[model samples]
Target: MGKVTGFLEFQRLQEAAEAPANRLKHYKEFVLHLTDDQARQQGARCMDCGIPFCNTACPVNNIIPDWNDLVYRQDWSRALDVLHSTNNFPEFTGRVCPAPCEAACTLNINDAPVGIKSIEHAIIDKGWQEGWVKPQVPRIKTGKSVAVVGSGPSGLACAQQLARAGHAVTVFEKSDRIGGLLRYGIPDFKMEKSHIDRRVSQMELEGVAFRTSTFVGSAEDAALFGQGLSTVTPAQLEAEFDAVVIAGGSEAPRDLNIPGRELQGVHFAMDFLRQQNKVVAGDKLPGQTTAAGKKVVVIGGGDTGSDCVGTSNRQGAKSVVQFELMPQPPEVENRELTWPYWPARLRTSSSHEEGCDRDWGVTTKSFKGKNGKLTALECARVEWVRDEATGQMKMNEIEGSVFDVPADLVFFAMGFVSPVQKVLDAFGVERDGRGNARANTDDYRTNRDKVFAAGDMRRGQSLVVWAIREGRQCAASVDAWLMGSTTLPR
Candidate 1:
């Protein structure tokens, strides 16, 4: 610990954002990173809890205490090294992760936790500014080839690691650009694309080849999540590459199949969000679905839903409302009981703070409209009752609780169910009952030999941090398989 009494001396300070009024006019990152002194002070707040639960809580298992002390000592060069030891992309996680590590901080038991995320954001930003981030070209070539499908966080992580391990790695991306979901699914206001661009440059310099607009599946799979300009058969990949890694994210969005789901103006959250991202990248989309000047209602109270709220407001929606079927969680958690673990509690994001009418325990029954255009949503208040047999909560609509709310546009953000089956089937990989690619965490190997799966593709939809962890681990497994042994970290 840099300072034994630092925790008692300083309180946690988070990054500040530009005013909503000003930020809504443009799609840009507004959360200001901490200043050098501020980061140092925040690092000083890291108490010697004897056990750094933040490390375990983080999906990538970052060495939190070491980096904290390094930052406190102003040894930023070493801090960056420590930051990159476990996580391949600290910049991405620092920008968008919800910071479960903070929730598990020992200080969070009774006080505000150390500002670990902001410190990380500061460290990576500084590393870039100082020209410290560079290519890690392998000294020797192993001559083994690897094909990584999907260029999202996980795929990128795995490809980078494999390339560093002296393998000839070629990343196949179905999209026109790299970064599967990060390039399309997330809003630009949260994280600009240039961050991904610079990382791609670094990876390219490290001897990794990127094949964009290349689909690795059967012809019928074109209609699935990733559409490609060119197609490569699974047989071709198997015959050429020594190993194949499926890092494609879970892209099968869960649909609301109630009555009137076919109505126009009702769309999946990704459709709206993806369009905005393309527009920001200078692509002109004709008849683009937007929330401008319309009453908007977003279903599902998750990060995607909050993104819809922020995007809708930015698009000049007249009104925005969010609905969640589950009952509202408490504003605060019982930290005493849930110490050293992620606690379940209400989380109000910056988008919510910008503007939104949020209602919990609300279910949409159907759409009420005419001429195939949505006009309103028929909804009902429901209560969750525990089922004795399953011991799981089931939704029950209350009598006389039905109501209608004006909704010119509706975005369903209920999350994804699984990866597109066509891609998995093309690779001859097995799937779990939940529809995700079936593979154990130990080796991330699928039923098919020379094929492995990781990230959301294997574990279903999860956080970006988790995806990076899986990618790193999967790369280690692939290296071990190809070389009969590997020195890469898990």
Candidate 2:
């Protein structure tokens, strides 16, 4: 530790956010990062807890204490090195990760925990500003060719690691651009696309080839292989590469099976979000739908739904309403019982602060519309209770709580069910009970030999941090399988 009594001397400080009125006008990230001195003070608050649970709590298992100590000692260069050792994309996680590490902090038991996320944000931003972040091109070529499907966080991380290991790596992306969800599903106000652009450049410099608009296992490409893949057809990817890794994210959205689902104005949240992202990227849409002057109703109250609310507000929607099936959670958790674990409690995002009417313990029954366009949603309040015998929670509709809310546009942000079956079926990969790609977390190998799966495709919908972690570990597994040994960190 830099200072024995540093924790006692410094108070926790978080990054500031732009004011609502000023920030709502634009779709740019508005988080104000800490100055160097303030970041050091925040880093000093990392108590010398003997256990260092924050490290384990982090998805990428970042060495939080080491970086915090380094930052506190004003060693910026060493801090960036330590920060980047485990996690490939600190900048992304620093901005959007829920920061479970903070909750696990020992100081969180009685006081504010260390602002580890902000400190990381500072370290990475400083690294970029100082031109310390650069491609680490491998010195020797291994000549082992690897093909990674999907260009999301998982695939990108895997490709980068494999490239640095001196393997010939090619990343295939179905979209026109590299980043999957990060470049589309996420709103710009949360994280700009420039971060992904820079990483893409770095990966290219490190000898990782990116092939955008290349669908590896599309129906047209099925004739290329002899033995077929279980999740993707074997013929499609067989002769092109020595090893194939599937890092495609979960894209099968959970649908609300209700009346008027076919209405023109109703759309999946991702469709709307992706379109907006494309527009921001300078792609013109002739008939793009806008929320302006429309009464928008967003289903699901998770982060995706919150993103919809923010986007709707930015589009000048007449009104925005969000609904959740579960009952509202407490504003604060019972910390004594939930400390050192991610607590289940209410979370209000910046989008919610922009403007929204939130309702919980409610379910939409049907959609009503005119001329094939959605106009209103019929919904009812529900109550949940525990069953005496089974001890399972059950929901029942309230007898007199049914009502209709006007909705000119409806966005379903209910989250994904699994990876699209077409891709998995094309390869013939086996699935678990949840319809996710069935692969072992320990080795990341699928049922098919020479093929592996990771990220949301294997674990279901999860955080970017988890995706990156899976990618890194999966790369190590693949490398070990290819060479019979590997030096890559898990």
Candidate 3:
């Protein structure tokens, strides 16, 4: 850890951000990384807990204590090494991750946790600025080729690891550019695309090839993916590469099939988000979906919904209202009961702070519109009651609580169900009960031979950290299968 008595001397510090009024004017990262002295103080606050629960809490099992100590000692190079050893992309996680590791910190049982995320953010940003982040090209080539489908975090992490292990790797992306959802779904205000571009360049130097606008599907499913995507049959990939990895995201969003879901102004949150991201990337999207001058109603209270709020506010929406099916949680968690676990509590994002009216236990009954264009939403209050036999909370509509929310545009952000079936169908891969690629974390292997699945495709919707963890483990498994043994860490 850091200092022996550091926990008593320092307080948790959040990364500074541009004021909401100013930052909302444009789509760019507003949060600034911590200064060297600020990061040192944050790192010094890491307690020397004998049994560090942050390790297990983190999906990648990062050695938090080691890095915290390294950073406190001002050994930035070693701190960067410790960070890169576990997380392939710290900049991504440092920016977007919810930081569950901090919640599980020993100091958090009483006082605020160490500013682990800010320190990590500072370390990576400094590494890049100092040119310590570079390509780790392997000494010898394995001569075996692996094809990775989808260029999201999981696919990218797996490809990078495999390439570093001397295997030839090619990443196929269906979008016009690399960085799958990272390049589109996430708003630029949260993380700019330059981070991904630089990493892509580094991966190239390390011998990882990237193919964009290429879909891994048959002609029959060609019309389903997109308009201008070039189709590549799964048969072609099997014949060309020794192994294949499916690391695509859970693209099938859980839709709200309300009475008037087909209203013109109603759309999936991802559809709305992707269009804006594309526009931000300098692409011209005719009739682009925007929240400008509209009363926006976002259904669902997850990260996607928060993003919709942020994007809507930035686009100058008349008003933004968010509805959540679940009831509100406690403002503060009971640490004695929930220590070392992700507790249910209120989490307000920077987007929520900018401007938004949020409601809980509200259910949308129908979409109200005029001329097939959304105009308002019919909603009802709900109460969660415990079932007598099942002992599970069940939502019941509250009578006479019906209300109308005026809206010009509505977005459904109810999260995703599973990966798109077209790719799995193309590969003839078996799916689990939940429609996810049937693969155990043990080996990250699907039913089909020479094929593996990781990330959301294998585990359904999950955190970015989990996706990276799965990607690394899957690469190790692939390495072990190719060679009798391997040195790659899981």
Which candidate achieves the best TM-score against the true structure?
Answer: 3
Q: What digit string (tens of lDDT, one per residue) describes model 3 on residues 1-70?
A: 6588888888888889999999999999999999988888889998889999999999999899999999
C-alpha lDDT values of all predictions:
0.93, 0.90, 0.93
- Per-candidate TM equals 0.99, 0.96, 0.99
Residue pair clashes in candidate 3: none
Model 3 / residue 214 / CA error / Å? 0.6
Model 1's C-alpha root-mean-square deviation from the true structure amounts to 1.1
RMSD values, in order shown: 1.1, 3.3, 0.8
Pitting candidate 1 against candidate 3, the one with the higher TM-score is 3
lDDT of candidate 2 over 403-482, digit per residue (tens): 99999999999999997676677677899999988999889998887789999989999999999999999999999998
Candidate 1 ranges with C-alpha deviation above 4 Å? 223-228
